[model samples]
Target: MPLDPFLADKVHLLDGLDWPQVQNDPQAAARLGEYLRDPGEWTAPDVSVEDRTVPGPHGRIPIRIYTPATEPGRALLWLHGGGFQGGDLDMPEAHQVSAELSARASALVVSVDYRRAVDGTHYPVPVDDAHAVWRWLGETLRLRSGPSGPVALGGASAGAAIALSTAIRLRDLGQRRPDALLLAYPFAHFPNPALDADTRVEMEALPPLLRFTTEGIESMVRNYVGRLSDLPPSAMPGAADLRGLPATGIVLAQYDDLRPSGELLERQLGEVGVGVRSYLAAGMTHGHLNRGPSLKEVDRSLDFLAAVLADGAAAPAEHPTYNG
Candidate 1:
């Protein structure tokens, strides 16, 4: 499969700047805060986007809500990616996709401020924050206009992984899980260096549009989880039982090292009769989806997501606004 030309160009374009430069980026931190502090130009005029906080074990868990013009309160949850270490709800890369989801899916998007790994081990911090938010939304949020319709969940990279864990946890507790799941190059599983050769090769290419590398993935896992045993289905949801889960949309990057895991995740869920579908983005890499307007494949993914959220597995959307 050939790569989308729009994304191919951005790889070269972004290469001009060093990834390491943004490795522990101060600018990245700033971008994460921009959506909360200013909220300017981050949303469309037809939609309402705002920041709201919910009570968490840690104190106040902040979430940014983006609602389409039609509904005051539709249900949706979006998580951002940053290796479980750093990411803000306001980062342009993070908010852009949420904004796109709001406009295209016609649902409200809530991006959470789950704690990062800057201080300790994986579960209790990031996962705890996510779990707290999940429980609160289901038990306390006081959702209006009837039962929560299409409580879809989605995220990118690490956020995708967290989203995976959150869904698994919700289902395990016999709580209502997201009506559907969308995971883009989800950081679902560790390399498992133990996989057979055939499996290893397949896992090597993620969505490709997202620009993931075995090396890059290794770094994120090492920085966040530390070791294989330390990881959890609460963290690596793919490692957990996916049976009886919600309808799922798994988006894989063509060039990402985590591709096979995402595929494996889809297979596992499907085996459990958990209606599932996957989109193999031709010629894209890890991190490509975050580029937003810079890549058409990203737009396609957003539209595909919107269509699914609004219409279910009816058909692939040709554009962002398609309601059919």
Candidate 2:
């Protein structure tokens, strides 16, 4: 499939633009925003939402909690993507996704406002924040016990990287792991796997602003970890020992440069005997979840995630892997 018609119609907005410049130029940024904007009218779902902070190593970590009107079947800690230096709990990827998942799966959703890899902040800060919240939620909500239902740790793009690192930390500490892991278009590997010929050709048709160039990926890694040399395996778990990790659900955007990373993660998890469920969002670019559920593909992606959460919650020990 090609790019979503909704996005294809606006690719002209990103003509001849690069991502780095968009950050400094208001007009360039606005045009990129226009290209990615959702045109549909969206209404917030009926879920109880609250903003609160939890104690962390650096300081208090901010988080948004959403509870469904009905009894929640499970709990999820979700992080939104923005490379590694951007994004917040207010983004639709964090806000709307949490709200909709809370209602759709009848699950308690907590969206973390973890520190970004900027302003002298680097590796372990963001991962530490996510781990702190996971521990807090486990203690306060009794997530480890079955009485409170299953618990999952999930995120999109860079957020997904943080979530996976936190999970690895828990595994190393011998702490109770999350019942499941939900990742969306994850940036799990440094020097991400090469794109196939077909994907490379398709990506060539996309605007530079819409694609993750090698330079951009390298910059993101450098910013997050300072120096790429002697990088921690847990920081990019694609190369780490993933044997003890919990069952995982990965959502890959069909037209994304990072899709290879997510696919590699799926194979890695399976090779380690970890059950995995992966969904490919056809005709979609990276970070589609950030657009909210207004687009059909976005809605379908959310539905797939909700179903994965529900399935994991219902049978934590019986998750089936799709290696092919």
Candidate 3:
């Protein structure tokens, strides 16, 4: 299939700023953050947003909670993606996605501001922060609809990896697990030669704007893993024994470099008899869900999520609809 006309245009319009360069240059990173922080990116006007902190392994972790005005409350614990190096609660990828899901699905959304690798905080730290918040949300907190409302774990990119790991961890510890999972274009696995070869070919066939390089992916993984010799299930969900994960909704972008991994995850879940639903957003690339109000597939994912939480409809869609 050819690239979607609109996304092809978006690719050409890209500023062509390489992520590795931005990470290495402080001024450029700051400027890029500022540019992405535009107030105009905020979406879902009907969702009410609030900021609060929860106890973390070290001090406090910030979180943004989004509540919709009319629907019966279902909750989601969300993490944002930045290759495990960048992103924040107020950023479009983090806040806007949550707000859109909350408003459209009438589900309460909680976005976590977990620690990143750039902060000299490596694998377990970020995962630990997520775990702390997950525990608090399950045990100590109550939603507007009280404590019994269904809560799921979710994230985009690295955040999705974290959510999946958190679910695995909760099951291992004999603690309550989320009712479902919402993973959007997740960075579900570390780089490997076979996967890398396939992704490289797919990326070359698509636009160059969001193409990923093996060197870049390796660098991000090194930053997250540091000197760790063995990665536990908490650090890498793909390395875990995933026999009994919760009902899951996975959204994959058609032209995304990570799409292969997302598909692999869906198959793995199914092989274990774990209920799973996956959406391949045709004509879209990675991070399309982060566009919030600008993309229809984003709403499609939220709709799937609402259905999963309301009633465990964890069956794959036959032919997904597109608003393009």
- Give the top-scoring candidate (lDDT): 2
Which is the leading candidate under TM-score?
Answer: 2
Decreasing TM-score order of the candidates: 2, 3, 1
| RMSD over all Cα atoms, model 1 | 5.8
Give the poorly placed runs of model 2, Cα more than 4 Å off: 143-147, 313-324
- Given candidate 1, what's the lDDT at residue 199? 39
Instruction: Give all TM-scores, in the order shown.
Output: 0.79, 0.93, 0.85
Candidate 1, residue 202: CA error in Å? 13
Each model's lDDT comes to 0.66, 0.87, 0.73
Q: What is the lDDT of residue 100 in candidate 3?
A: 71
lDDT-based ranking: 2, 3, 1
> Which of the predicted structures, 2 or 3, would earn the higher lDDT when compared with the native?
2
The sequence of per-residue lDDT tens digits that candidate 2 reaches over residues 9-53 is 998998888867797899999998777678786688889999999
List the pairs of residues colliding in candidate 3.
Answer: none
Instruction: Tell me how many residue pairs clash in candidate 2.
Output: 0
Residue 33 of model 3 has an lDDT of 58
Question: In model 3, how large is the Cα lDDT of residue 67?
Answer: 77
Better candidate by TM-score, 2 or 3: 2
Residue 119, candidate 1: alpha-carbon lDDT: 62
